[model samples]
Target: MGETFYIKNMVCNRCIASVLDIFGKEDYTVESVELGKVSATAGKKTNKSALASKLKEIGFELIDNETETLVEQIKVKLISKIKSGETEHLFQSLAEEFGKTETALSKLFSKSEGMTLEKYTINLKIEKVKEYIQLGQLNFSEIAYSLNYKNSSHLARQFKTSTGMSMTEYKNLKSWNRKTLDKIV
Candidate 1:
């Protein structure tokens, strides 16, 4: 049997690809790496700590235990909330399901990542909104409503606050930057 290590900020498939690439370079056959755990055998010629160091250098850190798992779960849920409106039940509103209060989650998240849960959630939402805008499938008003925003103007205001650019301007940019963010495990 191999070992499993949880990871933070691993919210997308690209993140998984990047992690596997690193392990492959070191001759480690990664068995599996989901949002919650990385299953891998101790390679004959690889140092797990050294591999960790390399991951850290590239902004990937190995995680362990329940607290870490819960945190990542929260982040993934928040990301999905923004992306596909998948949270029919808990849309940036994990308070009722998690047993603990959002205040407590926010405290733990802030201590771990130096940013509040709300801030992280909002940033992710903005990123997804940018994605929607770039794809040009949904209009600004529709996008705002889909994202659970009160109104198009409110969404525009919040977006401007975070990104310093209006939706109109961001969508109009000839050279736009599409973010290939982390995956949902």
Candidate 2:
């Protein structure tokens, strides 16, 4: 069986692709690559230390502690849910998904991340909103709907609160600055 490695700071499809590339270059037989985890068999020529170093060079960390691994899993699950726009009962669903009580999960996340999960979720939503605005394909209402906001005005309020600028002002900027998914915190 291939060994499974839990990774930190792998929060998007590009991160998965980057991990796959690193494994491929290192001659590992990659079975699968997903957000925050990989299953792979090391080839005879593969250097584990080198592989870890390369991942680190690109802002990914190989997580060894069990608690840290679980925290990374929580981050991956929450990011997946947000990307899918599953906003209803987010906390309750996350607890159920992990087979833990909401309070337990909240405490664990808070202890490890040094921020409340709700704040993290809000940060994610704001980043996603920035992406939508940059794309210029969707209007405010459409973006709000896709992100499961009550309406454009609600999204606008949250956006202004988070970003310190109106969406129109953001859209009018000469350059848009959006944070990478893994760097949300």
Please report the candidate that would top lDDT against the real structure.
2
Question: On residues 57-168, what C-alpha lDDT tens digit does candidate 1 reach at each position?
Answer: 8777876667777787777667755666754445336866577776788787888777887777677778788888888999999998887777899989999998788889
Looking at model 2, the pairs that clash are none
Clashes of each: 5, 0
lDDT digits (tens) for residues 1-185 of candidate 2: 88998999998888899999999999999898889999999898998899999999999999999888988898898889888888878889989988999889888888989998888888988998898888889999999998888889999999999999999999999499998878876
RMSD of 2: 1.5
TM-score of 2: 0.92
Per-candidate Cα lDDT values, in order, are 0.75, 0.90
Model 1, C-alpha of 148: deviation from truth (Å): 1.9
| Residue pairs with backbone overlap in model 1 | 11-182, 11-183, 11-184, 12-182, 12-183
Residue-pair clash count for candidate 2: 0
TM-scores of all predicted structures: 0.77, 0.92
Error of 2 at 75 (Å): 1.7
